[model samples]
Target: MSDNSQSAAALVQRYYDAFNAGDVPGMLACLSEDVAHDVNQGGRRTGKALFGEFCAHMERCYREQLTDIVVMPSADGRRAAAEFTVNGTYLSDDDGLPPATGQTYCLPAGTFFDIADGKITRVTTHYNLQDWIAQVTGTGA
Candidate 1:
């Protein structure tokens, strides 16, 4: 692995560390000003301001804990993939649309990050929505 690859992996690690520490500001620091984040289970959040909103919403809805984080080089050194499990506790009533049962849930997710100029420029995240619904509602197929 080259130095760039190692650095990229390190950056991904930092992201997970920030998340586990609940340091939203620190996580944002690892991103570029024009960062594009697609929180698959959530929605697309672009730019720093919108990203901050998304983070705030997440903090309001769930207490997040990153259980396992594994970072690896992707197609090139500039890109990396991180697989992680995020366990969350429902904090308040779900008021967005269909009300939630207000139950705790564990979500296993993966993220692919593209780094540029030592910052994360883009991130594509994946997770099972049905599993999340099941964990929250205690009902599913």
Candidate 2:
């Protein structure tokens, strides 16, 4: 990997590290001031302020820790992606979602990124919402 790729990987690693630590400020520091986020199965959210709100909402509704994180940065270092397993519990109800009963779940998730000037400018995330719902509701095979 080129030095740039290595640095990008390190940045992403730091972000996840902060996330695991529940260091919201530290995670926000890794994003651009005008960062764009594609919330999984939800609408797009932009700007760090909004991102912080989203993070807060997540912290209120779910307890998650990511494992098996693998980040792959493009050769040019302008883009990257990560895949991991989200081990979590439904701590509270999120709007339009099943009521939380502290349900435990493990889901594979992925996120794509646009990096510039050593900051994440855009993040697009994906996961199986139906699977999560099924696990939370005891309605799936």
Task: Say which candidate scores most in lDDT.
Answer: 2
- Model 1, 1-141: lDDT tens digits are 888898899888988899889899999999999998898766677898888888898788778788878899764568999888988888766555345446777878999888999999988889887787777776763
lDDT of 2 by residue, 1-141 (tens): 998898889989999999999999999999999999999878899999999999999999999999999999998889999999999999999999999999999999999999999999998999999999999999983
Residue pairs with colliding backbones in model 1 are: none
- Per-candidate clash tally: 0, 0
Per-model TM-score versus the true fold: 0.89, 0.98
